[model samples]
Target: MDEDNIQDDIRIYTERRWLRFSSGSYFPVYVLLAASYLLILIYFTIGLFKVFPCGPDTRQWEYFYGKCYYFSLETASWMQAKARCEEKLSQLVVINNTAEQNFIQTRTRNDRYWMGLTDRDREGTWRWVDGSDYNTGFMHWKPGEPNNDGHGEDCAHVWGNGEWNDVYCTYFCYYICEKPLPIRIKGHHNRALSVP
Candidate 1:
């Protein structure tokens, strides 16, 4: 081949070799960047799942409508029942609706249990243990009820018939405790993420 042609061929070969080397050198960097991005996405997804966990599993408590309930096997007076619930990071069960009352009735199953309602602070003015007024919500009082009978019945209890009755605060009876259920984000295959 002529001298000029030979030089041109050598130059083209050198250029191709340099291009290949440069591209090869950058391939690992691109892969590393892609890998880092994927890892970050995975981490954020895991964190999101953690923040919005699935349903709570109380083990001993029953779950219903975003709340967990515990029925005391033993009996206690109103004050003692309140203390017991507080110790467990819960409070006396507050009935908010017919569904809740039904649930409690089913759970208690003809057993008398102390409720969270009371008018001890003022006659005829009922309030929940959580300090919320109870004059406006669903009340399941029994017939001729809340007569403040004997002028001393201040605390409330659930009867076996799913009705409520006001009794003396010192009366001993079974009680129910309630707490907010942990956030549970539902997932496939019946999996749920539970928040701590």
Candidate 2:
């Protein structure tokens, strides 16, 4: 009888040991899975900024010659358009290279538009309306350009093929504007993006 009782006690103890061991082992696996889920959630939330996917206000801007551009302003005269852009703390669009000129031509709907390049200061010596000196060799002139026709034609206009032609300063036309992008805000975090 003594030996029988001892054997029964041994069996009970072994069964209890297995039950306790399995419970402890499975607990950690559950914990690991939960931790993995939490990590995935955190990574996804931080990776993508919360800006709207696409719209007029959330639109991305293009850059040219290290300058940022906006849609062409359709309202106002060439002079008034230039003044309006300046009032917005920007300047009339000053295209730098062939690629930029091509881009504006693509973006604009009107065939004729005003740009920063003008001959207003010296009548025949074309200069950027913003007073930036011309360094590149990307001149798109209509045939017989810079004729200084009628003596006071100091403004510049883009023709259908993206060519520049001298015109009177008072003539009105659509214009482009440029300004620095505002800082992006994402759920209390300030995000910076490289301009494309």
Stretches of candidate 1 off by over 4 Å are: 1-57, 183-196
Tens digit of lDDT per residue, candidate 2, span 22-97? 8796678889999999999887665543332221243554455455665563655678878877765677777667
For residues 1-196, what per-residue lDDT tens digits would candidate 1 score against the true structure? 6999999999999999889778797678888999999999988877654443322234567778877788999999999999998887788999999999999998888888998898899888899987765877888889989888785999999985889999999999999998876544456523443332
Count clashing residue pairs per candidate: 7, 1
List the pairs of residues colliding in candidate 2: 116-129
Residue 44 shift from truth in candidate 1, angstroms = 23
What is the alpha-carbon lDDT for the whole of candidate 1?
A: 0.83
TM-score of 1: 0.64
Once model 1 is optimally superposed onto the true structure by TM-score, how far is the C-alpha of residue 41 displaced, in angstroms?
22
**Least accurate stretch of 10 residues (summed lDDT) in model 2?**
49-58
Query: Estimated TM-score per prediction?
Result: 0.64, 0.60
lDDT (Cα atoms) of all candidates against the true structure: 0.83, 0.68
181 Cα displacement, candidate 2 (Å): 5.0
* Predicted structure 2, TM vs. truth: 0.60
